[model samples]
Target: MSGAQRETTEYAVPAGVLGLKGPVEKPAPGTLPLRGDLAHIALAGSHLAAHYVIPHVRTVGTEGAGLRLAPRADGEIFATLPAGSRFELLDVAGEWVWGCPGPQGPTGWCRASDLASAES
Candidate 1:
């Protein structure tokens, strides 16, 4: 033991219990490209998720695209993306790709085939 001792601090509650003091307001389901298990990398601090993913930039095909509430074709269409519109790709399942036009956006599902890599 040295003459200079380290100061120790303790918390009454367990580490896991330490978080925001009050209720947190979360964005609506279709309003953000965030799900219970995954979120956009840009939302890492603002939201909670088991994993955060960096978006892949993609552009709407010449025919344009419709952003739907669900992956299925019959799902409600909330937004329409014009041809060549830039999209931030988050998740993909079958024919649908889930993402937003930008970090702060009205996120939804669009046909994967309707989007082409921006690089191309």
Candidate 2:
């Protein structure tokens, strides 16, 4: 077989933090899988995180608020940021929404400019 046929695609981290432990969820509607780096922001009263989407963990933002962050792997709640939490936008869709990873095993949709890095 040709090298192309034998070769497989290496699933890069979906635009977010790293070393996080969670489950992987289905991408949003009309959205496709992204490679490396996502985007997020912090709530009105919350703290930010270092990385974006964690590897193998799922995240989900709150409902209606347009915020979600799920882990890529399945496990206990390794970490949490609670509502009004802070996050960085590793990926942005248009100028409205951002796809980010949250605490262990929790991925969902979120606002575009609602998250911020802990450094910021």
The residue pairs that clash in candidate 1, if any, are none
Where is model 2 poorest over a 10-residue stretch in terms of lDDT?
A: 39-48
lDDT of 2 by residue, 17-49 (tens): 344455455344323323334322221012224
The parts of candidate 2 lying over 4 Å away from their true place are: 1-64, 68-83, 101-105, 116-120
Q: Candidate 2 has what TM-score?
A: 0.27
**Clash number for every model?**
0, 67
Residue 18 in candidate 2, Cα distance off native in Å? 13
* TM-score for each candidate, following the candidate numbering: 0.77, 0.27
Write model 1 residue lDDT over 4-54, tens digit each, in one string.
Answer: 654432212332443445555888877877888898766655567798777
lDDT of 2: 0.35
List lDDT for all candidates, in order.
0.78, 0.35
The ten-residue window of minimal lDDT in model 1 covers: 7-16
